[model samples]
Target chain A: MSSRYSWGADEHLVVQITEDMSLESNFKAMAMASDLASQQVDGLTDICPANASLLVRFDPDRIAPAEVERIVREAEGRLEGGGPQVLETRIFELPVWYNDPYTNETGARFRDRHQTPDKTDLEFAAQENNLPSVEAFIEAHSGAPWITSMVGFVAGLPFLFQMVPQERQLEVPKYVRPRTDTPKQTIGYGGCFTAIYSVRGAGGYQMFGLTPVPIFDPTQELPDFTDFMFFFRPGDIVKFRRIDEAEYNQIKEQVEAGEYRIRQRPVTFDLAEYEKDPDAYNARLLEVLYGN
Target chain B: MAIEVIEPGLATSIQDEGRPGYYNVGVPPSGALDLYSAAAANALVGNPSSAAVIESAYMGPKLRFTEPAVVAVTGADIPVLVNGQSAPSWTSLDLKAGDELSFEILAGGARIYIAVSGGIDVPLVLGSRSLYALGAFGGFQGRALQAGDVLPVGVGSGRPGLSVPEALRPQFAKEMDVRIVLGLYDYRLTDEGMSALVDRPWQLSPVADRIGFRYAGNPLQWKEREQPFGAGSDPSNITDAGYPVGSIQVPGGIEPIILHRDAVSGGGYAQVGTVISADMDVVAQSAPGTMAMFVPVTLDQALEARAEARARRAEMMAALS
Candidate 1:
């Protein structure tokens, strides 16, 4: 419950929920951001909830900086009652082609910056986490669902945290030096979070796979992005389904023809219910997504 | 009527005040880097501050007007030209049909704001005409102007001869002290590192752009401690967090990058400090090779600077009116 409130220059007020990253911290940050947004405070431009912090951007001309701090403090106080953090969100089945050639080529090109130069990113990550093989790592990665803790570092990119206990969470360090290039739609990993690169650009995360479906379509040509260009949103749940290269190509063709539709379903995510037994809660959520 | 692009300069894009409220979804506030200069240009052309304008970096574009218009240029110390004849900047100039507009070599500053009487008419995406090139959604065709691109101009009742006084205009400098309000993970830096941030002058690197302005300087030192769980092993790394516009992050503690208007919303690097709001325009004016000395100030001082900047804008508006 320890939080540090600091100024991000004169325009932004950043509230650090905790020094460490955890699901609870992220929930608190997201809750606070949601609460602040509902208030419609004047001068408040953006309310960004990150891994373990909440950043509020405002205009000093419309409202005083001290007033912003006071309002945020009041919002933080409301969360002290331990209200049920229930979010009615959507669950998406994102197909990931693990150890794909695209990412494999990218990983090979940047081996000089990797911790294990001789091994692929998937193999190195599997070894680092004590998994028997890359196959085992894929199961561990795709076994459970992940929550979109934050969406940033570029347009439409979503940072995901696995829905598992702390001890079971897979941890991996980023590249020794960030590669100058990372293929768009690449599923990369760093620290305890996995990210889907919405667009091709410079990245520090370890390349593990690539997704055929577009998470970010600026043209909004895809059906999933009909209403918005970004396919993922904060609080959305994602289940990564491992697919072969053949399936990836099939989906890619469908996507190019604008006939592809992402598998998704609306569901309620309750923090209290999840805390009791994450595995059971996830099971029920999956049933809701796939149950006919 | 429309303006035809004869030559696309270094990086010319349509920009306005910016798009806000969508940062939570990773959409940056893509807008004019130097808001003050853009506003001044708009004011000269009798356009509202929110009207879309052309923001050219390093070099200016050569444009041909299909019809009569009133235009003004501001921001960089570049000379405006009308059919090869030198025209005064900061003053609205009348352009006849088929009149060609261009610019001389940039003497100072890195960007120029060109505001036409009728703002560049473009469809508003997410409530903005500003371009977020990385996202490729807003502005003209969701990208920078290319050769032979015909840009539609909105209708207006703007008059020529309006001008911003020389005394009120911003002055560019080779060596400038950029004010910063240090906080947000600044505690991760050692005392010596903090001292070095403000004591030494950092040169602007070539990597400077809309996303961020990178500075070359001595490596900063981080406080010794075990890397926290979920945080990377790099001494300069922190748990991924939100980055405010103008936030300064030194990745690997080597180069400090000041995230600008088009910056990513969040990242893993520790943001040691944020440039004060009043000085972001100053940072925008800096070109490659400019020397910037980071100066830390208290919150109260930062607010005072913001108030002063607001007053200056008011004065300029009153004069133009």
Candidate 2:
């Protein structure tokens, strides 16, 4: 399902090709080429979209592996000269609706790890993090459109890469037991940045927010195999604007009605029963517990 | 034409090849597990490769033919019968409106494919008739077949199927080896771990499906220090790379994951190998408690094997035609 772009420019040129084997290499190659393509096809710089790959957008006609190679070759010679690199990666201050319960408690003993070296009370830094909501964080820190990196190999799951080093510390490992399945609009954290699982399916990434708006529409394609339209590019900037609760509910209702479910039926076991003889039923229970 | 569902035996749904090109948006390419068998079933009945076949796990659904139609049943070796008579597999059959079709427990594979000549008349969701059970897209109401679920036969039969010869129907083995190609993180395993992966016979976990088939009897661990998956991810943890179909991934060092059709678009586990396309059908056929042995092959060998399989399949199709 993953395709590669051969060349990079400020605005991405759609090409098609037969996808061969190595996936990571194809993604890297497209990113490299698209970066170079921002320069003019001839010698003139084009004021095009400042990005490389359409992170998640792939159609029969778009940036496929074969076409990517040709694009790379076509734009290769002229890119060596100085071109106005218009790629100013826009920093977005995400507006966060932080629901963290105790802002005061978090400030009390938070002085352990993150110290500013000014000897200022580390609790003071927690106050800085006290953005009103998730949306507020987006509003303050990010001044410009963000640069996109790779798309999720999974559908609808946007994997935004290369967040500022300061935000790097916010990444954390996923929960011990991942959810069996989540909604399509469920935005998750992969420790790299935020991504929304555009479809309901299995995932191991840590969850952060919920975007009820359906990004991938099955109705639009309407069974015409060739006409399915999926938007978003590898280098495309995705600005997360907070939707109102009313909008969220409307989309949520639609999403809940019908969609694909890709998970095993979860079997529930009482914790008390398992605790009684955890090791006694290891062999027999393994078959039932893991369903393997 | 609609076929009335009398008894939706075991787990059943309609599937075609799959909905490809949606991994970027977190969608798994939901489709048939035993792809060759599914296609073979459709071809025998003069349907295109992309038809919604009835994917019945274990026991097949009981359907009452509503019109004169052509059909075939393949995969998983579930003993099928029409009015209590043994039915042929991988061959076309002409049925009447009064005929009742049913199946029993599969003796060999975990599932069997039922393809009608006209193809299943399912609403195209994202350009596929296949069902994605997670997001609940495609197929009969985007879920498994129910007692009252009636399937539509789309566009009736095409060209008449050639009389199937004796040798054309594929005979799947009760127990077999699944071929694998070393994955991106194959280097992370210890020699012993790799040896166990290929040499030992692992049992297919009951917890198997289109998403993934968990294997028991193997505790494959990384020779290197195991790290939590992610950036600043504990040193030694494998980052979440894309988990392709047939990927043999290890997480928690307890069970090995054999990813399948409905697998997540990505994962953080270490993918040690991938079952080659040539043997992916075999993996789909392995039933719960079935012994599964993994054998390694080089990239060149895998390609050659695939080519050979394609050629053989083509020859069969041509012969039957």
Please give, for residues B1-321, the per-residue lDDT of candidate 1 as tens digits: 899999989889999999998898899998999999999999989889999999999999999999999999999999889999999999999999999999989999999999998899999988899999888778889889999999999987778888889999999999999999999999999999998888999999999999999999999999989987788888888889999999999988999999999998899899988999999999998999999999999889999999999999999999999
The candidate that achieves the highest lDDT relative to the unseen native structure? 1
Model 1, A1-292: lDDT tens digits are 5799899889999998987889989988888888998999989999999999999999988999999999999988888877778887899899999998889998899899999999999999999999999999999999999999999988889999999999999998889888999999999999999999998889989998999999988777778888998888888999999999899999999999999988899999999899999999999999988886
- The per-model DockQ list reads 0.85, 0.13
Task: Estimate, for each residue in A1-292, the C-alpha lDDT of model 2 and write its tens digit.
Answer: 3333311111122221212212222234343345544532342211111112222222212234344345554553333343432322222222222222222232223323322323222122223457555444444323222334445555444555432323322344443345455445555554544565666655555444565545566555322122443444454444454545565566456546644211122223222343355334222333442364
* Candidate number of the best DockQ: 1
Show the colliding residue pairs in model 1. Answer: none
Per-candidate alpha-carbon RMSD to the true structure: 1.4, 14.7
Candidate 1 lDDT score at position A237:
97
- Candidate 1 residue B145 C-alpha distance from true site, Å: 1.9
Give the CAPRI class of candidate 2.
Answer: incorrect
What TM-score would you give candidate 2 relative to the actual structure?
0.70
List candidate 2 segments past 4 Å from native. A1-97, A100-148, A166-169, A181-184, A200-205, A220-232, A241-292, B158-166, B225-229, B232-236
**Cα deviation of B110 in candidate 2 (Å)?**
1.7
